[model samples]
Target: MPAMTVNDAPVMFDMDPETPLLWALRDAANLTGTKYGCGVGDCGACMVLIDGEALRSCLVTIAEAEGRTITTIEGLSRDRSHPVQQALVAEQAIQCGFCTPGIVMAAASLLRRNPDPSEADIREAIPNLCRCGVYPRLIAAVQRAGRVTRRRETISAAPAPGIDPADAARAVPAMGPASGGEADGGTTEPED
Candidate 1:
């Protein structure tokens, strides 16, 4: 039996030593989020996080994954609240849902490496083939996730409040629809 940590929990597998991690996860561990697409490393469908890096489970033998951290899409979040998952949902990036788990894992890995990935960066990082041709929406989702991650980082990195409460309340540029009128050289009448 091989002992390993799966989804932050310890798991022991009693399968063939040469069995791929994909079967060990789905069959023995009951973690089906890691799909088997081409049974080879060509497709990203079997992608999973191994020690925080995206790896194709099909190509990795049980011995290779022993004593290492393995995180499946199911372990990404309990409520499916991972940024990648949330962005995919918001963008309606799902088609048949068969490819979503792998895509989600791949996206997570990409975001971890580049929090503010550009469209090209996302395209380059994520090579997971989607049969439905949802590349545009997937790109949009990656962009949105990047924005959210940046916003959170900004908020968390803000300095402590100044001595004067008034100083912390400094005014910011108007961001409402009225601001657009100003940019377009249009005057708005004062409300009565």
Candidate 2:
């Protein structure tokens, strides 16, 4: 077993020491926000803050994480109020959201080191790929997050945790009721 501080809580992984940190977090610890993307570390979907740096969880083993601090997306903010998160929403940088967590982690780490990162700095820091093609907006979001962190701006876009149904529906248009006979528990046969 290897011990480490995850999300400010001390945890001892019961799995093999050689297991990748991503699996240990997702499978053993049941922290599913750390996604599994490109197991070879080319994709940053499994990015997490290891000892205050954004690193690919798929490349680091549990043994390598021993005696270190790991911060997953869940640990970043329980209510999605982290500046990076807020900025992401405010800038509309998230679409499909699969890579958002990793991008958020990388952005958070970068802002910690450089509170006033330029566009180029953001580009270099956040190599996480967004298949939704949000690169332009992502850069702006990072910059906005830095500003929020520095007290130069404020964002109210990130919804609080457990948003009510009305607010949620307003944020995203509600889908119309299920059509066809399914609404009444009846099945529609396939067309011949």
For each candidate, the alpha-carbon lDDT, in order, equals: 0.81, 0.92
**Candidate 2 lDDT tens digits, 29-132:** 89999999899998899999999999999999999999999999999998898999999999999999999999999999999999999999999999998899
Tens digit of lDDT per residue, candidate 1, span 18-133? Answer: 89999999999889878889997877888999999988999998888999999999898866667777787778888988878888888899889999898889888788888888
lDDT, model 1, position 5: 91
Candidate 1's C-alpha runs over 4 A off are 152-192
Report the CA-based lDDT of candidate 2 relative to the real structure: 0.92
Q: Which ten residues in a row have the lowest lDDT in candidate 1?
A: 153-162
Q: Model 1: which residue pairs collide?
A: none
TM-score for model 1? 0.77
